[model samples]
Target chain A: MSGEPANREPVDLAAKLASFGEHWSPRVVAGFNGHDVMVVKVQGEFVWHSHPETDDFFFVLKGRLTIRMREGDVTLLPGQLFVVPKGVEHCPVAEEETHLLLIEPAGTPNTGDPATAATKHAI
Target chain B: MSGEPANREPVDLAAKLASFGEHWSPRVVAGFNGHDVMVVKVQGEFVWHSHPETDDFFFVLKGRLTIRMREGDVTLLPGQLFVVPKGVEHCPVAEEETHLLLIEPAGTPNTGDPATAATKHAI
Candidate 1:
């Protein structure tokens, strides 16, 4: 068996979500392998943008999320996931308050442009 | 808005879990950034192993999962996650059938040994 390192603990997604109330701002919850697991609460439409260097992952935790692209819109409910390939410009909108889990490379900007992206806070 | 690529669709975790019944076998459900998102069903106990080069991520979807390390064990319930850092030898056990979501670098083995690892079937 491997020795557990100090501070290694399970992350409770629900508890993390409950700790914050801000919308659109993502909070870093856990990380591994150069990736950061983030949680965000969102409602309404977000700016259209594309991550030119990395794909964007979104897993709906509660409510509904609609990813709108030029071709069409993909709606996701809780327990569903969608991936937006790199360089694909899209917008995320939630008709109701929605909770989301996002997996992305560390330092990835939410708006694709670092200058305009919302600051990612660790929670 | 970004143009949606052909074959882009949301993945339902529940439906994917229901489609398979084998224990300890993982099915690749999605891929991005040289990483694979996999779903697995596990029960009983797994062999003690460690990934020498990559961290192991686990998110419990149903039932209970316990990751046993030399120092201690971490138990996870639905919506909980834990990351086993690289080179940490550990074993996963489940007294009841459990559904899990795992994220790791593509080609990483379940047993840490390629020859003994279960073949990852894409579903």
Candidate 2:
């Protein structure tokens, strides 16, 4: 565990997904390198913003996620991934209840705007 | 796609996992920042090595993966993850035909040693 302490205990996916119930709020489940792997249940639309310095990786675990960008929208079904590069304007919309895993730099704000209530909550 | 071109197509995970039947070899499926999101079907034992400057991340997509280190071995099951810090000698052994997703700096060899045959192939 000391060698890979971030996630030494094997986390049961279904159990972790079932542990939380909320929307747009990410719960940190593990860490890798300098990034944090988080899970969130989302529905409706998220704020339009962009990370100025790091990319955002999103993997759909359940349902679907449509990321609205300047050009078009990218819809991600379960088992799909999308990387939103830094400094790009984007918004994520979940038409139905969607389970997602997000990977990004540690301590990154949930929304680009720091004042947003959903900024950087580990749990 | 251009804004988030690395994984713009929203890759079908099942299809990708289904596409390949081999084990140990990693197929590049997408990128985040400068990192590669890869999936590999692994079974049996891997070499003992370490990346000197970058951390290596392993996520269990199916079955289980055990990373052996000096202190102890970290066992990862489905939905579990672990980050091997830079310069840590480690070996990965999968008890069964385990499917996994690896996230790390692009161009990293499958094994730490550069002379290894299984070095950096994007399938």
Candidate 3:
């Protein structure tokens, strides 16, 4: 690859989980340019917030998650994807539990707030 | 989420494989802004080419592969990532078999050649 190539072996979700044991917190899995790719295990409910200057993408690696927005709610199952626009307030919740792989800019606040506890957990 | 947020559920490789059986070809799993995130099942050998105006990224979701470059070769496994800079000629091959998740600009040529056989498979 012409871009900064990082040669790595195959990594499984079970192996990634073995590296951490926290809920609602994300851990760094890899990086590209100035961005950080994170994997998070979430259950129950998460606070509602929005990123004003950056874009965020989420892919469920395992389980299911429901994203509640100011206008409506979107439930995502395996193989499906949803997009939340910039400055759109949203809350993510899982009726049971969900595992997700998220990609975004480095230093993005977890809760989209610089002063919130979730912000402290940014991977 | 500030970016074009795509809410997607956990998509396992086996499930994705059940959707296709072709080798060296990719299918679209999701889209980001003007870009497309694709998953490809590849084995054996691939041709040499380069994208001139875009940056391409690859994450080894499964298996093993090596990128042969003019200078040297880089072997990649799962969890490892590589960025192929624009205009760099590179060839990919596998000693065994490999699956990968590739993200790049939508409508990009597969072999970086707009008129080549590989260009017909852009997902």
Q: Which one is best on lDDT? A: 1
* Clash totals, every prediction: 0, 0, 18
Instruction: Supply the TM-score of chain A against the true chain A for every candidate structure.
Output: 0.94, 0.90, 0.84
Docking verdict class for candidate 2: acceptable
**lDDT digits (tens) for residues B27-67 of candidate 2:** 88777768888888999999888887678878787898999
lDDT of 3 by residue, A28-110 (tens): 76554355667788899999888876555776666788888866787777544555656778899987778877766688887
Candidate that beats the other on DockQ, 1 or 3, i.e. the better one: 1
What are the Cα lDDT values of the candidates? 0.89, 0.79, 0.68
DockQ of 1: 0.56
TM-score-superior candidate, 2 or 3: 2
Runs off by more than 4 Å, candidate 2: A1-7, B1-7
Off by over 4 Å in 3: A1-13, A78-80, A117-123, B1-22, B49-55, B59-90, B94-99, B113-123
Judging by DockQ against the true structure, name the best candidate: 1
Q: What CA root-mean-square deviation does each model show from the true structure?
A: 1.9, 2.8, 4.5
lDDT of 1 by residue, A41-67 (tens): 999999999987888889999999999
